[model samples]
Target: MCWQFPLLGIVVDFGHYFVHRAMHSKFWYEHIHYVHHSLNDGGPLTAYYSHPLDFLLGITAPVVLGWWTIHGDLKAFLVYVFLAQVGALYIHSGQSWLGNKWHYQHHAKLKRVYGLFGISDFCLK
Candidate 1:
């Protein structure tokens, strides 16, 4: 699990970056991701405000793929997923836990700062 952790992280990073970026595109935004952005001043539960398909593609699929890719331990994978969801909740809650600025800025300018850890957005910038 230790060995697979970084690999899963990398896979999730790429998957999230691409899926999130795509969700912001005009068609997707209007139909799906915009539902998420509707709560401009987000709450703890804002992370789950998205369309069902948006949630599946933008959140669940990446983690599932990463787990599958690594043949991850079920317990460890569940823990990782729980933590990630909590992090996203914190981010959207505007609690200043970490990464709040990035996501808030994303709300400010919908097309920028699409990645979780900021690496992909930084490179794109």
Candidate 2:
């Protein structure tokens, strides 16, 4: 069913939140995630301008977690990938989603708010 997409999205959100928070640590932030952070202003292009490792660990790893959880459904996973891309572009554009201007705040302040959906922001932070 279409149900798994939402479940997968939630899984990815939490996973990404933790990975992103870790990326903000002293070493990783300066050496890796800083590439994304340095690209301030939260433009659409900012979404794609992360360090290779930052993209791998911060984005792909969590997506893989969700895909693995679902036991590897290629078609479904591809759909999730597309949606995640759209989300990345949108959030990086400084637009609010579900009441949170996520990447905008993240880029502007270089502080908290790491999750895609804001549940993790409220619950975890």
Candidate 3:
């Protein structure tokens, strides 16, 4: 929540970013990513409303990583899950800069916006 934990945050961020990039790739998009594109005018109700491939990449990857590396600490796992949900809410709300709309611009102009949220744009761009 604080974004203060260095190691876990870094690992999770990197994993989410990279995995998300793979999902946005031409191969994946040609098949699954577009299902989400159908909701460009999306809102709060649209959150988690993703295609099956999108859901697998965004949600399953974190759980798999936790199972593999975190030794099954339910607390840490739940925290990560919470943060992910928060991030998704903020990202998909069609807003980027808290109040201003700069971030959401990518959603309209850039087809992929890199990842589920806009976090991967810096790398995926």
Clashes of each: 0, 0, 0
Looking at model 2, residue 79 earns an lDDT score of 91
lDDT of 1: 0.83
Residue 64 shift from truth in candidate 2, angstroms:
1.2
Give the alpha-carbon lDDT of every model: 0.83, 0.83, 0.60
How do the residues 10-119 of candidate 3 rate in per-residue lDDT, one tens digit apiece?
A: 55555666765566678876677667655778575466777876778766775567345645555666676777678667767866566525335544664444443344
Select the stronger candidate by lDDT from 2 and 3.
2
Q: What TM-score does model 3 achieve against the real structure?
A: 0.68
Model 1: per-residue Cα lDDT at residue 97: 54
**What tens digits encode model 1's per-residue C-alpha lDDT throughout 1-125?**
67666677777878889999899889999998999898888888988998999999988999999899889999879888888888888888877755377788788777477777776666666
Error of 3 at 11 (Å): 1.8
**RMSD per prediction, one decimal?**
1.6, 1.7, 3.7
Q: What ranking emerges by TM-score with the best candidate at the front?
A: 1, 2, 3
lDDT of 3: 0.60
Consecutive 10-residue window with the lowest summed lDDT within model 3: 1-10
User: What are the runs in model 1 whose C-alpha is more than 4 Å off?
Assistant: 97-99, 123-125
